[model samples]
Target: MADATADLAGASPAKLTTADGRPLKSALARAQAKARRRAFLLVLPLLLFIVLTFILPIGQMLHRSIFNDGFAANMPQLTQWFVDNPVGTEPDESAYAALAADLKSAAEAKTIGVVGTRVNYEMSGTRSLFTSTGRKAKNFEPPYMQAVLEADDKWADPQLWGTMRQVSDAYTANFFLAAVDLARDTEGKIVQAPEDRRVYVMLFERTFLIAGLITFLCLLLGFPIAHLLATLPLRYSNLLMILVLLPFWTSLLVRTTSWIVLLQGQGVVNNTLVATGILTDDTRIQMIYNQMGTIIAMTHILLPFMILPLYSVMRPIPPSYVRAARSLGASSWTAFRRIYLPQTLPGIGAGALLVFILGVGYYITPALVGGASGQLISNLIAFHMQDSLNWSLAAAIAAVLLAAVLVLYWLYDRLIGIDNLKLG
Candidate 1:
């Protein structure tokens, strides 16, 4: 029975083994495993580097989007007031007195202003109410709620105070709510933006449009160049390939600045056009500081990304396929179209995807070339970080960008099959 049990256990063979029936019992097997372990250990530094440098920062940024404390942290006194005031029909004088004293303290300390701004973004006119009460509270004596009501009857509405009570949580979905230009009601319902503030939805639409246009332009401009480079003799193709890669040697800032210089009214392009009498001086195209400038610069920058992928793909396709099509009585264009284009579709899809993905999150090129009307979503992200000093809002925008990238990647993988992609 013990022998059978030992045989059953041994029936599961070792993972590493010699060609013969013996398992990996020799020093060579041990040495191989040791080498593999050493190889894994060698890569450990890179694994830790990626986790610490890339993954942790992204995780932390995403966390901040829903982990804000602006309202709850600053308005502890307000929350205490609400808790002390029971479900009674009338407001209690004792709670009201405490609230008045606390409001005065919050005003002087600027905590009320902080909470007020957080609330006003959701509930309009809340800032004015907070500031007015906080600033003027020092003059009011005991029974200050009555004095507060006398100053602004809005305080007694209960609706205003109820709204305040509803939003006393440490974490909120406010940033995500504002991203799509909606806000939550007192009952935690999604509602459309107020008429005057309906800009974000339009901005989101504009961002997608710009990204799509850039993708189209990259594909169109890149396909022909990639085909030529892939098909031509090595002597000539190598020279052309150098030109394609030359842009990478130059600084991106330099490239953007060069576009600005060339495309501006008093710049080289307009000057050349006017001098050539192609158009009147008054009609010199106003290209810079506009959407057109953004498109032109971005297309130039991303075109190479499209070309490289397509070129790598087309180079490997044998010339005999086109020759065979022609031998079958196909015209040159027909042979190229039927035989060549289908083959290049994989490359085209890959190039288009790469360019589109990169173009979506572009910030520097757009910021430099694009004016107020031309700013991409990334520019708005930068604005939240710099001007508003709202790190949570910035993180929310970044999270949205990341989610968009993930969705695009998922759709691409589903539609195109990343496993079938051939880099060469």
Candidate 2:
């Protein structure tokens, strides 16, 4: 025993080692690093896919919101003149001369219309000014200010000069300001847009209000169905779930068209009501092609999203808790309110966020059913993209919508924790 003790005392501590003779700690770290690298390699394709498809498009839209070169690219000389001169400077002879040279060059290049169109967005009726001036540009001699003003007396207007100065820069916030129904006056102070042009803010408010109503409707209609499914046997619940999922199998256009048929003035519902003597033919309700149609169609379409989440959260909640509460003299309503309803909140948050986000971005249903007054902000964004062809304004509107969604998502994360969002 003494010899063993002396041997152990004399021996150096045995270092922990792997089979390959490396220290165990180092081996474990290397293994962990290798596993982490393998995991990252497996996920790299998805990351690249998201960056390319989602992140890159959003970044491009954001860049387009502030960067436009219609005036700068076509009228380089005038752009440079604006750079040299400060805002609110009255145009002198040199400024008019620079404008004359730029107009002449733009006319020759056939880009005068492009520059005019760019300026027309900011100051209505200026496209004609740019085009007409370009047409008579070569006739102007020295002392071009007076000669140019002779072509159009409107050129002498300070408001026109201010607008030109504002748009002369290659980058601007005017599109964003316009998106929010604001504009910069000749004095360079931000002000409310003209009352007639103040539509975007109203559209945004309408969009949010409608989306909230749709979310609430979905929750109200879905909660009872979800609770029934949760309480039912698997056989019955599966049959009921098929009813909920049937809408998903149908095309959205087909469903929307069906609603149109059902809701139109002379369509099925009105005809049935009239036949039943519930309403006179002359007093048939006008339902389709309005806000009411949009709400009914969207609620039906989004109901499953609410039902599935609520069902998933409720299924795991044992009935014994409610039964125990009832046995302890609690009323059914009290047991549900205190012991059951709170548990389903995670599902409520998940469903409401999903439905609200999707509803805000809805285009087809609203476009088809929602008439002039019923139209939402997304409709205007599409109008700018397709009809107006003002892509910068479209980008600005889209950027604002995207920002609002991100803010709501951040708020949800803060309040409810994203980890609690369970779809199943």
Candidate 3:
């Protein structure tokens, strides 16, 4: 018996083998490794697609926000002068000489316009200053300081010089400052933009305000509809679900245009109200092309986003829990607050986050429906990208918006555990 016990101890579990005479532990590990490899292979294409499409574009946007070489690349002489001199050092004779050389060189190279436009971003009306000066800078005589200043007295303007110093670098945060309705003065001190020039800040505020209001409206409007879908018979629920999802099949333009037609002053809504004596023709509400229009249209469009998440969560909650609470002497509101609402919290959080994000980033809806006051930050970003042709400023604004969204996301994660979010 002692010999047998010793034999059993020597025959350890690690030494065990499978029926096929393979080591059991190694065989199980090999199977697990193969399964992991298969799973990775299944997801590889999605990983590549995300990196190529999403990650690369965001990386490019961040790079573009701080980089613009138009002035530095075209006006090498002036860039070198700025490099040699520290910030706040008054420009001397060599600065003027370098300016003259660069202006003349840029003129000859036909890149003076590029340099001027770069400077023009910081100091308005300087494009013409550079263009007109470039025309005479080529013929400048010695003591180029006097010569260049003589060509254009605007060159003597301290603000103009201050702006040039800031723009001399190929990379700068001036664009970002401008995006936030702030700017660095000639002395390199940050200051608020002039009242008339301040726009982006207000638009950003409006964007967030509208996004929050829309999310609230969606939650109010969507909650009951989701409950109906969750509690109704399967056949009826599926039909109602189709109605909810029908918007996704329709073209966005068609839906937006439909709202325009319905809500416009002379459209069906106003006409009906007038005919019903609810409103006079002259007193027709101005719903389209304003904040009301944006909110109404956006709420309708994003309703499905709220409803779907809610239904996904609410559907799985057994009705008996709330019923059991009621049977135990809980009032209807008490049962709902204690038992039902807590379970729905995950869906509410998910839906609000999704809707708010989509609302903040929405562009085409606001652009088409939003008039002057209704315009969001996205509209301003578009203006910089398409109309003003200041991609750096646009990128800066986008980056700021992205940061705001991230901070909001962080707050949400802190307030409500992100892992609690229900998607299905």
Candidate models: Cα lDDT each: 0.81, 0.92, 0.92
Q: Which whole-number lDDT from 0 to 100 does residue 412 have in model 2?
A: 93
lDDT of 2 by residue, 149-236 (tens): 9999999999888888888887999999999999999988999999999999999999999999999999999999999999999999
Model 1 lDDT on a 0 to 1 scale: 0.81
What global local distance difference test value does model 2 have?
Answer: 0.92
Worst 10 residues of 3 by lDDT: 8-17
Report residue 104 deviation for candidate 2 (angstroms). Answer: 1.9
TM-score of structure candidate 2: 0.94
For candidate 2, the 10 contiguous residues with the lowest summed lDDT are 8-17
lDDT of 1 by residue, 1-424 (tens): 9997787577654544566745665757778999999999999999999999999999999888877666677667766766655433355575567657766888888788777776675677788888888788788876776887777777776556555665666677877777777876655578887778776667767877898899998888888999899889999999999999999999999999999999999999999999999978899999998999999999999989899989988999999999999999999999989999888877887888788878878899999999987888888888888986677777887788788878987887898777646545
Q: Give each model's clash number.
A: 0, 0, 0
